[model samples]
Target: MTHWRKRYHFLVQITAFSLVLYSCDVTKPYANKQTVPDHLYGDAAADANANMAVLSWKEIFKDPLLQDLIAEGIENNLDLKTAAANLKAAEANFVQSKQAFLPSLSGNASAGAYHPSDAQASNTQVYQLYALSSWQADIWGKLRSTKRSMYASYLASEAYQQAVKTQLVANIAVTYYQLLAYDEQLNIVQQSLEVYSKDTETMKILKNSDVVTGAAVVQSAANYYAVKSTVPDIKNNIRQAENTMSLLLGRTPGPVKRDSLFNEQVYSELSTGLPVQLLANRPDVKQAELQLRSYFEQVNVAETSFYPALTITGQAGLYGTQLKNFFSAGAFLANIVGGLTQPIFNNGLNKQKLKIAQANYEASEYNYSKVLLTAGQEVSNALYQYQMVDEKAQSRQEQIANLEKAVHFTKELLKYTSDTNYTDVLTSEQSLLSARQSAITDKLQQLQAVVNLYAALGGGWK
Candidate 1:
């Protein structure tokens, strides 16, 4: 009895010690210590609360056909689907983690006959039935930390899904605009072909009248063929762009329907808002932050492992040699035991676990920082590109006007006098065509800039 009392006192002391440690709170709650500096968008950013990312994709990509394509991509894009699946899996893991705090119970029954080898020995029947339960006390908040970690992972998965969705919307819109630009370029090239044909005929008449040499006539024809040869390459580019959009929509390669580049309009004001808003807007940024939070909890879990674990196990059963007496009070048995385990030595495994967890948490912090910087870079680049393209619009039109006049003036000079030649006409005409094409490209750049900025601001997923 004295020995038993000593053992009981020892158990009480251990329990008291563990409870004291528990009161100290070995796990810390998650906190955001990350900071974002000023001027993430450089000097060009408009300091406003109204971010374009807050708008729905429909508001940004006002084109009806482009909106339809973005909708289709959200519904069918395989990467988005995969992200959704990952979210479901993370949710399941979080649910399972919550269940870890509950006790586990199991039941079992068995029957057997036992007999001696001697002939005179009588056979005996044995029967037993039992139920067992076990539970581990979370004296160090280990289970709580694990649950929080899983919840963070689930949130990260959700952010990942949204990131995929935003990217898909941007891809669909960008590719659709590219197709439009290609169509316009093709139209411009075809128009040039007709004009070149007329100029070639004019050159032939001039050569016949002795106004120009054979060299001039051949040069005019050669210029026409050169412009015509670009047709196939442009068509091929259009086909490839269509296929790219088709892939984004998770469909077979085919032609994509789109309005003319000049007809598409984005009415949303291009306000970039504050750079600090990236934490809430950018899905990838949010995901990285959540991942860091998860790792923080994991480190807490690892720290808890170095402490003691308390578990309780209980069993209740009925046993009897005879079936009729199995239910009697005399055959009833029950027992319960509480145990405490403290790791004394394990080849430094516990220390190793803590070190590994700490390293991972630190690594996640670095990765999170990198993601923030990248987000800022994207916002800055998109805004700068839009500004540059917007500024070039008036100059581009003026340049095209000048080139057009040059082409016309050169043609008349070749017909009237020897002051200019066919080479001069060809050069001006080519310059005019190039300027027109560049104008179309400038429009494309402006459209893509808006799309990219919207995406960079974490738009479209809402």
Candidate 2:
């Protein structure tokens, strides 16, 4: 057969094979068949339109100081910076993956001398320069599947970066609030310590008048020192909390200035959107979904490998013994070759790889489902915590008010009647002190609950 006719027949055969491979999709098509629960918060209907996570950090965190802190954390936090670097690397890899279907060209130059085996022949010199290129036809969408997998992985990395940013903002806010709470607790202890000091002095005077025994004086002094000792501990907690905030800011250990806990305000009511919204709002959940897509694409890629790989390679260049004739047509050498490689006997390597790919895909499926469940659980836990804290706040306030009245009434009654003793005064003071401390803790826990709920709802990452 003539060369031209042979080339035409090869082209027709390649075209037909390409069409056949493209038409048959052996890999199972991926579908998101995950079953979302009826409602995330166990409600009959979902508030699909209402979404709290959509609100920016500035909107949810009312304090300007915390807002500034969050902004700083987003920019300066080392974890965020690392995540950004990973995202950039993933983006570059994805871009590189896109060039898989494109031909790769390489150049080479060589100069060598061939020695004659017989003594009568002279050594000959040869020089050659060549450009070589190769390309694999993505007849079965193998390159496309690999590219898609990399793209999904890149998206997952980006979503993971957002998740890191969200966590950083929450950490900074929580740490800053804890500092404020510790400061308030310290103030309470200080004020109570002074009052106890005065009571101890009164006890001494009563002991000198024989109105109270030695045990009362000792007990009053002990109570005063107990509150006094808490002062240093609370102050230490405040300093440690400040250090933690500084760490979140990616700065050296230092003080974090902020508003008082009482002044720190968050959104009154959280608007959690539909359960489906978590797939979009929560970065972790979104990342898991993307990971599942990436692994699925990998399975497709692995499956495609079971078929023959069609590659076309070519090289053309000049070669000559004499430098003068190197560029002439007589020195030119050119060839193009097309080949198909089938893994007829690979010792089960391909099958093992396919099995691994399928297993990884199944693992990703489990991860995506687990992440969805975990998201719902987190939101539910935070919601219940916020509700419980809010419910107790009122009762806690009432307890504080009644305790204050009891302390005042007991102290006043002690001076007016003999039946009221030093023990009664000590007990009232102890109860009042405990209630006051608890009030500060209650405020702190309530604030922490709000912070947690906001974070669980995928807030602060916007």
Candidate 1: give the clashing pairs.
none
Q: 77-186 in candidate 1: lDDT tens per residue? A: 98999999999999999999999988899998999998777876688899999999988878889999999999999999999999999999988988999999999999
TM-score of 2: 0.94
Q: Per-prediction TM-score, please?
A: 0.93, 0.94
Instruction: Give RMSD to native, each candidate.
Output: 3.2, 2.2
Q: Compared with the true structure, what per-residue lDDT tens digits does model 2 show for residues 77-188?
A: 9999999999999999999999887899999999898898886678888999999999888877888888889999999999999899888878887788788878878877
- lDDT agreement with native, every candidate: 0.89, 0.82
- Candidate 2: clashing pairs of residues: none
Top model by TM-score, which number? 2
Estimate candidate 2's alpha-carbon lDDT, on a 0 to 1 scale.
Answer: 0.82
